[model samples]
Target: MGETIRREWRVEGMDCAACVASVTRAVERLPGVSQVEVNLMAERLTVSLAPGASVAAVEQEVAALGYQAAPLPAPDAAGSAAVPGAAGPDRSEAGGHGHAHGGHADDPAEAGKPWWRTGKAMLVWALGGLVGGAYLLSFILPQGQHWLFLAATLLALIPFGRRAIALARAGSPFSIETLMCTAALGAVVIGAAEEAAIVVLLFAVGELLENVAAGRARAGIRALAGLMPRTALRRRADGTTETVPADRLAVGDLVRIRPGDRVPCDGSIEEGRSALDESPVTGESVPVARGPGEAVLAGAINTEGVLHVRVTRAAADNTVARIIRLVEEATASRAPTHRFVEHFSAWWTPGAMLVSALVILLGPLLLGWDWQTGLYRGLAVLLIACPCALVISVPAAMASGLSAGARRGLLVKGGAALEAIGAARTIAFDKTGTLTEGRPRVTRIIAAEGAAETEVLALAAAAEAGSAHPLARAVAAAAAARGIAIPPASGAGAEAGRAVLATVAGRRVAVGSPRYGAEAARGGLGKLAAAMETLQGEGNTVSVVLADGAAIGLLAFRDEPRPDAAAGIAALAALGVRAVMLTGDNARTGAAVGGALGLEVKAGLLPDDKLREIAALRGAGPVVMVGDGINDAPALAAASVGVAMGGGTDVALEAADAAVLKDRVTGVAELMALSRATLANVRQNVAVAVGLKVAFLATTLAGLTGLWPAILADTGASVLVTLNALRLLGWTPRL
Candidate 1:
């Protein structure tokens, strides 16, 4: 009745609302589907079924949607992802909910009363502590009270220590807990109950602290998990508006963007113009100007305009949706640092027990020794040989480190993958989406011949009033921002190119890019190109606007540069990594954005060209490429290390090796730093564990240690290493 199944999938070429709806409808028609949710933003659809819902059925539905489904991703299996709020829909449901075959998060084995925690686990621990304290007081109170401590210890051991006994019997006998439990039990059998209690209680404390660290690191990730806005004003056939969930909005539906409202979806302005604050999308401080025919995003605030918008894409396919999807997918793929304890369990734990048994049996027989003496030596070996320190060290560090990165808005999927590439000495960047802001902005305006400066501007603005071209939009936006009113343009004539000839404010206006308007002015090409270079040199994208056979204005647009680009690059340099930018934009735009942000810029390269550049960089050392969305997907896959932005497409997110959960690429630096820190701690912890084990083993074999001290040393070192690893919880940089 509780049988469960799951699979992963890839959604291709799903760009907007209609595509998402088409796919969602197709997916919902499958057999045995109890419920289906198409998280279009994630480019992944989830289906929960009652019975008889086959993986094949789901695959067929995906095929019908022009996509393919496959198994879920896996890199580091042991490190648990600190998912927030239902794990953002990917993890399915916890608490006995069965996940797919590859890996499922099951309930903790044994009584999971890890120490350093509160609640049920903590209560169990406190009771055990009370029992031990009571037993100790019995010596001072009544002799019969000793049983109280013994009974409490045995009960606690039954629940939590069952796993320890199983672990001891298992192939890997040198495990951290196996060692602690053996030593604790040895002391108890010898009637030294308090030492054993202390060992188990302290071990639980360390485990509890590690869990808390991990929980804290992932504390606020759920804050934005279900932030999808519900209702929106949709414009319809009679010019009437009705409210609907932004999710229900479809393409070509008119959306009303009232003042002080977020744009419901990506769309073109059908009516009105106003200032919009797009800080959430671009991390920019300035309010941008948007007018009729301009593009507005789903998460942007319309500051002053009453925008009547024709939805270009559905709510689930909007920019905000894509951004959310990108973040989720990127986060899902993270890998944590090496888990030494689990890995060593295959050999180290069992090997320790074998040697302990040999020393007890053979050593006493070979030399003149009594059975009690040999038994005690064997017991001491088992007690002090506990690999708890080594076992707990790596996981504790990894959990805390990963959590810390998340708290700072840098989601490193787990510890392993981070450690794999974060220390690379070379970093590459994709210019359009990674180094520069991905959008073009209007920066300057120029005047052409046969027109006064203001008159030419007004005419250009008017002619471009209804354009969607980047250059035209820039000019119009600039004019609108300055409060210049442009009358309706005359009937457009000759649609041979991107421009139209028209009359505005009773003046003839031919508005378009430089190539659109005929060459009527002298040295026009030279003038335009030169102006473009100058602006480009300063790290701005320049487009020439022409009107009436003359170059009327030089319009510039730059993708918002990352504010922390300079600082992040410097940090990477300090870590001995060189940075370079590769972009598909023209040389000027590329150089401008890069130079402004103090990056090494490589511009005017196609997709293949970017790939070649990456291959070339790898010749020097491993390369980490940071980018966002589709254009960078291929290059990201090809790079030695692919770091995608959380604000990019699922394509890029799926391809990249790592992702920064925040919209900016700066998180990449922070993630790498945390990974390095975690790796360092893992190494340090392992060394401490091994060193202590060797010394204790040698001392015990030489009969220089008693059962009491041996048990304490064995369990105490593990507790120490485990606690030390938890220190990474707060080890983040000042990002």
Candidate 2:
């Protein structure tokens, strides 16, 4: 065994799933090639090669399959080096004929050309003219009509026949081109020249329609890359600004943003305030108000005021760039349904050819049919069984679904995750950042005898100022909000998970859990015990302040649920999915939060305990775990689907199968709705593709239809299937 290296190439003219299979098969046959993956939506091919294999051989093999291949630079060469439209040769350019061995050309250049200027359209027009000329000559000289029709059919078969031969030699013998050439040649041999001419013309027109639909789908995903501005206004140390390419921006560079201009990079506001419309990156419809010190994402539009922002992320690491990369990567992984369709089509194509052979040979011997009749019926069967429609049903829908989700800030990793999320039966939510705001706030305060509320808050804030715990921050924030001055504390230290002790104004002060406060207070809690009980019962975490071994005051902090938490839970219930909350918080606090949102609560759980609950929840059906902290990473990976909130830690995002970038609890329900809708669309497309094939095959074999109808059955079904799948690109949640 030798070391293996992986390489990626941008492929041209891969419009359908069958094209992907052809490219895969051709490259896989090369010696020393270990693995191959083709993503049709992104038009990318990835191959792993052993040490002895050469990149030239891989490119040659793909070229043999009638697709153009170009090597991509390493991912980290430059910030936007891997981005599609960033500072490189135009990928849309297709050299030479701009045609593939398949029946249609999906080269980006060809797809964008005017309909009358396209090669497919030109072919259709030329063939239609020939057919029309033949018919006109028939009225003037009936005896020469057959010869003229034969001439037109032969001319049409020249391109089709050449492509069929190339595809056969490249290991795809049952391609649509092969079927078309075979049917048309058989028609000419049987003296149906006029019908053959019409059939050829109709097939060309069908290919044109398929190409148009495919171009539309590709355009939808490619639009995301265009959100980034090409140029950025960079500010220098002397307070002067210069316009430069966006990709040249480095971290910490300040840039001025004008009203109605798209932000050039991900940055934080440094000088002014403005309302930014972030719909392009986050799908947020309304413009959000942002002031100095707030972060802004690249691709957001500055809708109101002038501002200067300091760049926080490089061009390629911005939100828009990441979204584009993630979408392309997602399209590379095949879902279970997509894999099944591909496998089924692989067998169906060859099997259909075998059945066609039997129909032609056996009909003459067993059914006493004439030679011409048997041959004609066999050709019809071949046309009816092209397999173009059935093979494309799954991928077309999956691509559209992924693109639609990306547009709405819902990023699924791939088709597999998208499919799994749709079938989620029970959803488990982590409490802190996933359900509540995750930031504790001071809700109430109780002062003991001889202690003013301000005095108590000031002393506690001084002791907690040195700690970074949530409760400590809450106490400090409360004191600051009240404009109370906190004197400097000396010898400040935090006890592990318990308390913080400090010397405040020459007197020792302790602030932390109620138990720690009681221990420090030599004169017990006394009158403050009842107040502590009331606060705890109300689901608040109480931190007591003590000075000179005497209790001073009690601070009650509570993390509240988000505004949409209850509505989001109700939405899941409406969809028949049960929502549960799993938290490490105490049972009383968890219940208080969960109860308000009508969710079942499993409180006081460790990391391992959450995994157990996830495993138990799986018994009923698929489980989707939503979390935003490192503690939830285990359960997120353990569930059927893991969704990370965009505001979550990096570890949680890495562990999750999908991410909700808008950081809204309502996004969870929206993601579920989108997934279910996409699955339904796939089912509809498959049913349409398969149902038409069965119906047409039966009719063709019974002698009720001929070559024209057989060609329509194949080409028409493909167009219908593609159009149906494209509907998912515009899908939205009913809620």
Candidate 3:
């Protein structure tokens, strides 16, 4: 048996893809490092070391490269392992994958089990006590409800408060429990126990709310990951299928998929094909056909016909597998601002508690105020300082925004990304899959002078019908859809990719992936520009036309149009963004999708071209890039803002700022709506937090305010802010 050693480290300053790669390569280059994966998206790097190597040494090595690596953020600090009665971890940060550092997952849970502290039973008990305690105080005694509530509150607080006071006394008061102590003790001392109990009780409620929201926000990714095919049908020399672990699958492995089964990983068909339901990955309702040599994705369903795929990528690194990884990574990564907030509360809550105590004590001693008055005033200050508004606001709003986006088919990976989108005003759309349907479909066939549209299409269809290229599929489908009767397709003489050169009913024709199709077209490249310009307006791909080796007509095809595309783009524009289309397709196809969606179009772009274009667009303003699956991965990573269809591949989503969980184009619009609303709520919460403080300070200095009022105002503000943030949960953009 091999000896295994693992360690956790907080990796820092790696905010880019290159940074991630650098860390990975540096660690892997080390003498004993077997595998080093730096998840910049999760802000953590895990490296498998040989028997004698230390993770700390690797951390130092990465640090030498100017990337910081330290012990992973504590469960109580950040990263995974759940925080409760405090702000929960960002969705991405709370899971297996995140930007935060990591702990050995196989190690024992920090508190014996993740549930020991954050479990539903503890949550229910802790929260129910607060509520039940608050309720008892509020109704049990009218004349001294405050006193009754104070007693109930103190009893509740004592169990937790003593520890907080001790921690604060020990110079570690800034924590969820300490904050509770300060608020509860202040209320009891100042004769405003009801408010204090209410504050703690409501804070508990917010914790419960946090629990529910966290579960919902995380459920989407978990569900997606869980949906992966559990087993694959391995093809053996006997030609029989046997069940096998998907991980054991390798390139060129023969696998079978039947009706209602997902294609196991991305592969090219070597044997059979079918009409596949790629709706899970493409967001298109229509099932698409696949034939010999066509690549099939892991998560796509085979609606009809059997498929024997020769795997192209290993199951672990398959399209769907990578997509899930990306989603997890994106979710785990936190934004710069979120970190600031997390750290801010990690220190602020306790400081306020101390200030409140001084107000209670020093006020009476220095100013000759009544002990009761000073005590009451101190309690008020403590209530105000609970930070219910601050702690709950950011993550709550994020959770709601994420859930809302997911419902609309958009997947926002983390709190930071969700927050970032609200600030993006310019959106760049990838023409192929993001805006136009990625698959090429024939929309129009143009005839040369004196040639009939039907005649031209029939010729191409008949010629292409014998070919297996996409252009052939489009030509055949178009001819059939238009009710044109095609002569039977003949097996052409020539190797595949050269040209399916054949004569259909005595008319010479050819169709191929590239030049062969062009050679068969009559007009050659001369009519290419004019033909493209005309067809581009219709948002379709245009292939060349040839008749007896002279270019004669133009063939136009388009990717499927997203159902809510025009409306989604319009909605984006309404949000004050300009839409631009970028694609790897030829200029004709690019122009076609761009013109239809009214976006500025750039065609024939390589990944680098897409990056440069996005850079230029960002020079004008922040840009939102929307795409689907992995082809859009690079541009999605490059844009000022990246969005992916949730139904698409996870890699694009990992590279994106947001994912349309429902994979509906309109989800992008809804994401904006939710984001704007969340920002508004955050602003309102800040106002409430600061405004109450101003009033409390002024009243205290004037010698007109006491503990009871301060407690009420502060506690009330906390609840109010929490309520406001929750409003985002219900937000909708009429579109």
Model 1 over residues 1-735: C-alpha lDDT tens digits? 775454445442222222333445555655666455543223455667655668777666554333445434422333222121322233211111111000111223311323233232443367566666766778887875646556655655553454444333333233444566666576667666655565556545444433343233233233333333456898778889899866667778888888988776778898998998765554344787888887776677889959898988665566555544434443333243333355664466567788878877888789777766776677777766655456556654565565455445454444446666666777888765566555555666655444355665577667766765445566677777788777788875634333557776565556543344325433455556666667767767554445445566665566677667777787777766688888655676766667666778787676688889999888877777888745577778787767777443344435566666455655666766777787888788778777887878888888887565665554456556655765775675655
Question: Per-residue lDDT for 677-714 in model 2, tens only?
Answer: 98998899899999988888999888898889888887
Overall lDDT per candidate, in order of appearance: 0.58, 0.81, 0.60
Query: Backbone collision count in every prediction?
Result: 35, 0, 53
Model 3 regions lying over 4 Å from their true place: 1-172, 182-213, 229-258, 261-283, 299-321, 336-351, 354-358, 361-369, 403-417, 429-568, 581-596, 600-620, 625-638, 642-734
Better TM-score candidate (2, 3): 2
Query: Which residue ranges in model 2 land beyond 4 Å of their true spot?
Result: 1-3, 74-78, 85-99, 102-112, 365-368, 444-533, 541-555, 647-654
Which candidate number maximizes TM-score?
A: 2
* TM-score computed on alpha carbons, candidate 2: 0.87
Instruction: Give each model a TM-score.
Output: 0.58, 0.87, 0.57
Where is the poorest 10-residue window by lDDT in model 1?
96-105
Candidate order by TM-score, decreasing, is 2, 1, 3
